[model samples]
Target: MCQKNCRGDCDCESQPMGGGQRGTKCDVRILLVGEPGVGKTSLILSLVGEEFPEDVPPRAEEITIPADVTPEKVPTHIVDFSNQEQSAEELSEEILKSNVICIVYSVVDDDTIDRITDYWLPLIRRVLGEEHSTPVVLVGNKVDLVEYSSLELILPIMNQNQEVETCVECSAKTLKNISELFYYAQKAVLHPTGPLYVPHERELTDKCKQALTRVFRICDFNNDGALNDFELDRFQQKCFNTPLEPQALQDLKALVSRQLPEGVREKEGDPKQGGLTLAGFLFLHKLFIQRGRHETTWTILRKFGYDDSLYLSREYLFPKIRVPAGTTTELTEKGHNFLKMLFEKHDLDKDEALCPNELEQLFSVCPVVPWGPELIYTVATNERRFLTKSGYLAMWTLTAALDVTKVMEYFAYLGFMSVTNAESQLDAVTVTRDKQLDLQLKQTMRNVFHCRIIGPQGAGKTSFLQGFLGRTAQETDEIPRAHLPRYTISSVPVYSQEKFLVLHEIDIFSMHDVLTPPELHCDVVCLLYDASNSKSFEYIARIYKKYFEKSRVPVLVVASKCDRSPVKQDYSVQPEEFCNLHKLPPPQMFTTTPATAGEPAKVSRDIYIRLATMAAYPNLKRLVHVLQSRPSWIGEYTNQMMELPPEVTAWMKVGLGAAAVTVMGLLLMRTLKNANTAN
Candidate 1:
């Protein structure tokens, strides 16, 4: 196919000077995401040899040129952006257009793991729609700090989920991981057969513009090209200005006041320069803008023509000019005026601009606790909240402020926070009592214990619980007096500082629910089986396999109603044999008898003590005590037939139903309105 022979050196390095082809077709796009100050830009610089700034700024720019691999011969390009100033939608749009994704986490900080799972990963999935479209790599950046246990702990959690392609622990600063990270990202992009199609600027049409406009409306102030303190101040003020009672407002304000303030440590001379600079204005501006939100903000800034050195050279008007760390090369008087105008235009009445502390207060109302107060403060003072689980939780928790503590604590417990100490074996009177505790006995009621009761309708599962509570089942014989396990447990409300725990159901938890990232190893699991019903044993076995497959905990297999069948030789499988097969402790089999069964109730007392002794963690006990001490409002509404006039009752029902419907309708309308505005 060669028409003309290639000339000297001929640029014929193309195809060995034989064929007339330029090169093999290979293209790749990679996105950088990580926590702040993790050397993302430095690592990128080392790999690509492109000088990037420390400070981040709004707007997107290409930061790297195509590089060819020596051995693999894969052509690669990186598209780096920040989550600081853009919404998840906007960020997703950018990522969706890319071929490969790199999620960076600093091994020094355990918090980054949550950010990757709860925030960044979810957003990526939403954009990519399929996990395979863009291969993801969970990067443990800053390998120099890998000695920390938190880093060790973090890697396990990421590995447990098994979501990412591969995890690499490398140091961007030491250039330890620089080459490896590039290799991994390039590998992910090449895994798929087709090339990643990145659209040109024309793709962001009028629709995207409208979407961006609304995002700007929430972020921008005074119709300026950039964000400033005034816009941030207003946002914080609006959050605290709830339509609640005065006492509530005061309480809310007190909580808000505990947050970090804006510009507090921002203007302390730049790290490289000894003198203060007005570049602090640009720093603050970036901090107060959206693109300034994530760890990659600095990387994005380098692409946008700003760096830390320039920020240090500019002079400041205020003794403490607060600005984001990396944004402006130098802050001029003009930058100061642009920022000042935003304050004048939007926050004329407010004296204080949004600070880190105020932003924390503002975020407290979200339903899910944001990743941390630092991120929220950064968002409010600096105008961006990095998308992370913490950020999502913070926003959710703040907005929902209703019983958030309980949800957070439960999640923490599940994460495996030590809830209680193990109980010591003590001598007790009941013959059934032994030094060894049963599965249900070891985990105090304070811990999360799941028990399944199986038997015919006549079985004693409900009877056993009622008798343990010292309540007679006969007074209300038609309806069992046994207390059903509640979805959540709550302590009585008090304005006391003494720390306490609350238990709640997991079903109602919102996306923003602030979960405590602690271990929640289950303490006890009990499978109650009736000796009279052989079928009950099958059910118990199934429930055990389903629930306790992942949980490493003590299990008790209780053979209830031994009095009915008189402990047959093969009455259900042998407890010891069952335990041995499952690699668990031997079962605790006992006969349970109620007055109706014509058997002595003395055995019930012995079993109760055995169970209580095994499950005795202090925290779990306190939770039980707290639940037992609840106010009357939480009492079950048992009255079915009312003594009031039928007409009055009917009217009451109608009124309540109407009110509920109206509220629901209003909420729907408000949601629709907000959606339209955002669109």
Candidate 2:
């Protein structure tokens, strides 16, 4: 029966109307279109019943089943046109009557897949007209026979060729991914969000652009340039099959209002409250696509009261604070109790202080803010070695309120009196601390250097570290397992010149771990790889690209376990070649074995000393100061300037006395000679 005005010549509108209308029982008409022998019948039978037909007759059939399996409990109409012969006109009429279309191809035969673009897609497009907006799903059957990777190559082509919302691969025989495929198709029809438009790669095609334009024109009744709230609701229902919620409509309004120009709101017909212009409509679509519709930008928008949920709950907005039983006698006491709770939660080991790891966990749980190890060490810990409970409380209170002086006084009353000391006394303490730090800095500069060694599992990283520490492979008890990170400080000087603290760990793979503060500040980074295993080298390369490429610190690459293979294998990449491929410097190569005992140790020591020296005196200014301030240089300069030889002094005195006597004699002689000459 036709629900609207329909001509009897075409049966495109023959299906019952309002079957899937919102807030009622959903009845979807799904059309199955594909090349011959693509298992369309088997897929349909699998979806509707348990048995696969041993023999499928060449016929056209319709199976109407109540599908209580879905979350919505909607009935689905499955039309199988597997072997039916029809003219182009008949096919076009059938296509128009469908709610969703699934185009299937056999994965085993690449030719069948090619015909999807060459034949099936073009016919559908020609019949439905260029501006039609029905959703399409591309299905790859017989996935069990072909490698999944083989099917991946042609998926993008299908997506580009048609209004393909999603592509899925399933085996009707094994029933793999069949249910998921149908669910996606149902979603595409009911909640028809338009095709995603990624900025560079996935863009809206001409067809999509035209469809959207037509949609906008249809919604803009009276041919107005904009759409009001009523118009928008109508548009949402007609285009997406689902009406916008009241909150959703308001959010759309708010978004449009914020985007308008300042004076435009005060114009004669202020568009802010009047309607959304065509330009505004396009802009919102682009924004929703570019920033993902949900995770990041949408989440932020909801927090600002743009969505149904007014804002993030208090737990998500603020850190958890628990009040102690008797600590709420006063308001200040209550606040202090809250602070104590926060510190206790973060101090997982219950040590009353936060280690580097514990502090990182705390920062992650707190409301979104700028965080890093340097900030925690400087502001929260007041440049101290660790953050205590009192320090955490003080930092939070100062930031929470506008009156910092009053907060400091309150803290002083709570036994943090040093915080309220006189400015002069504070200055003295600061100067003394600075001087002490300077001395310690000089000592560290002369004594120790830090290196962080990182690599993949079984890359011989731990073995290399053990060798450097003068431990044999047989002494397994002494070596820590590679799965866990280890920290070791060498008391003895490496290369008999520089001491080193080595932090050995695997590469960080998760986002949570990456946000945390590192336990130590390293002067140099050492990347290790096993020469026998090519995969280890590849892992190191990926690590460098992901993490180390942006770093300004010096990175030293080490090729370990060279002794495992006497001759270079074809699979193994030479250290120089690997470095060249990555545009990095050539690495230091070493072999740690019983036969080559003490050789790797010496080489490791040399590498450490060279890296540390470069890190410590990276520029000429600091190097010059260190040299000029050396005790030996000062003593040598003082002795050279203040001391004189006795023989040279005696010679100087004799020469001066003789010069005076000679002058007197010469004057007397000159006078006698002058008088005689004058006479």
Candidate 3:
């Protein structure tokens, strides 16, 4: 058979072709292209071979990769070219001749990254013919610059087209993702020998095959060529089919066995058993099978511990706080008990097993506010990559609330105490008993002004909280008889006290639901944005617009990720612009860098003092006026509510007495607490 020469510039003059390498058919060619400095040429050079160049030359070249399945050459051909000033018409002429094309951009360069589709694709389509399903790979180069990359855009754009074989981010300088690019591209272009591409995950593909292979080996016992009717029937009955449906099991076995590799007859000796051995079958399964959905199973394993074996025995299963590595994990006794309670309380249908969707619905009910996409995505993936530190802290707060007997009962006490408080006069913040916070700011956080911290993912919202607490604790170490507990929304203390409530990355929906009237409400809102990426700045709108009207309180705009650089909150816009843009007063900004080796860095006392000052502004006048009225005004409430019993009245008197003693201590009224109170 004769094949035409596709990329030929010359033709033979009526010459009869002889059987030789020169008369053979040409292989399909492909082109790789990108901006001038985007490593288009380097990728081809590495795949083929080239001599070392002392300095990079400003030129282009082409190389041929021969096809061979033998122990020698691999089948691949790549043409490397530059796209510095090429027009769409010229690039189209080049692309039409190639079977595949790759579009590359630096992931960190927002300008070039956006142009891949905006500038390149239309040109390619106009010149090369869109009717042809010519596979294209969107390559995001320089992924090592993760902090600088626009995740908001990258994730959405990559998700736009599922038909795209793979969206990859690689750093050419580090050679991080080069191999994966080649592997994925090769798989997308079909191979004549077999199916391609095995997923990197373990349980989804690898473990499933191991289980199947074990069953296959058992059916093929006695080193026979294949399983007979009795053996097949026994296997089906043992695995999934039941004994009551004997004929159905028998028929299903016959159907499955036929799909097995051919040439192996049901005899002791046969040539068809070449790849049918247990190990070979297992290998082939791993090499070819698609990974099944197993996020739920994996989540369970992660929460518990995977025991050494993927399969578990009933005995090794017990709840340990930490999951054991290298094993199929079993739920602990506590976990089992918790599951039983959950099923009994929530699942009215009473199905013995609950799937992932059901489990998510159950957890969602625990939140006072409805969960949003970000929180739902985190729950579904069962992996923590998408969750920020602040989000985790918010979850921790909720978990602590659940720790008490009832959720509403706990929040009622929390709600009541957060509303009222007395002022403290400590010059600085300090720590006592290693667990309590004893800063002057606690009085303001709980009693004076409402404060909230908000920010984008990884903008150091949690770290800022840690810094604030640590600094305040250090400042008031000299104060005797002072104890302030680190405050969380879930475990907020009752009684006439003040504390900073650190609510982390709150999902906007959840916050709104909780803050609705006739329920829990917040006094202030903090709007945080990331400094390194502009998209974080835009996200500030989504949070503020949702809750600003409901809050009717001051909103402080915090630009997080400030440690990447110094804080910059000064915008030229005036108050009208703020209203036009729906933004709060530009936040009082702060930046922080990591501590150096062997040096412990705490929050500066100056920042804490400033924060305390701002927080104390709202209630200082009211508190001072009430203090001026003194003993008469304070006792008015106690005297007016005459429905109280004598014992209850006595308890109230004791509480008032304690408050008076605390007030005297603050005012230096006496050297001690009456020296002998019982007397």
Per-model TM-score, in order, reads 0.24, 0.30, 0.27
Alpha-carbon runs more than 4 Å astray in model 3: 1-28, 46-54, 69-74, 84-87, 144-155, 191-679
Off by over 4 Å in 2: 1-26, 84-89, 195-679
Q: What's the true lDDT of residue 94 in model 2?
A: 69
RMSD of 1: 29.0
Of candidates 3 and 2, the better by lDDT: 2
If the candidates were sorted by their TM-score against the true structure, best first, what order would they fall in?
A: 2, 3, 1
For residues 235-263, what per-residue lDDT tens digits would candidate 1 score against the true structure? 33332322445454334333333332321
lDDT of 2 at 323: 28
Q: Once model 1 is optimally superposed onto the true structure by TM-score, how far is the C-alpha of residue 507 displaced, in angstroms?
A: 70
Candidate 2, residues 1-679, lDDT tens digits: the string is 3322222333424322222232111466778888888888888887666656677666437877675766446566777774466565666776888777888888888888888789877877887787666778888887877666445766667546546656789988888888887876776565443433433355543433433443344345534457776677766654354687978876776786687532112225644346677666665655665443412222222222121122222222222233232111111444455347546755777777877776665444223323333333222232234776654653443233222333333332221211122221111111111212322343232333446677766766655555454444554334334322243333334334633343345553422234132422345667887777755666666566666676534566788776677334243466578666654546766554454555542224454454555444322212222222334644564465446576765675577558757865775566445434533
Native-structure RMSD, model 3: 27.5
Note the Cα lDDT for every prediction shown.
0.40, 0.52, 0.41
For model 3 the local lDDT of residue 666 reads: 66
Which has the higher TM-score value, candidate number 1 or candidate number 2? 2
Off by over 4 Å in 1: 1-25, 50-61, 67-71, 146-151, 154-163, 192-679
Reference-based TM-score, model 1: 0.24
Question: Tens digits of per-residue lDDT for model 3 on 289-395?
Answer: 33321322222221221221333212112111221221111222232233344444334345443344544434432223233443422211222223323333333
Residues forming the 10-long window of minimal summed lDDT in candidate 3: 422-431
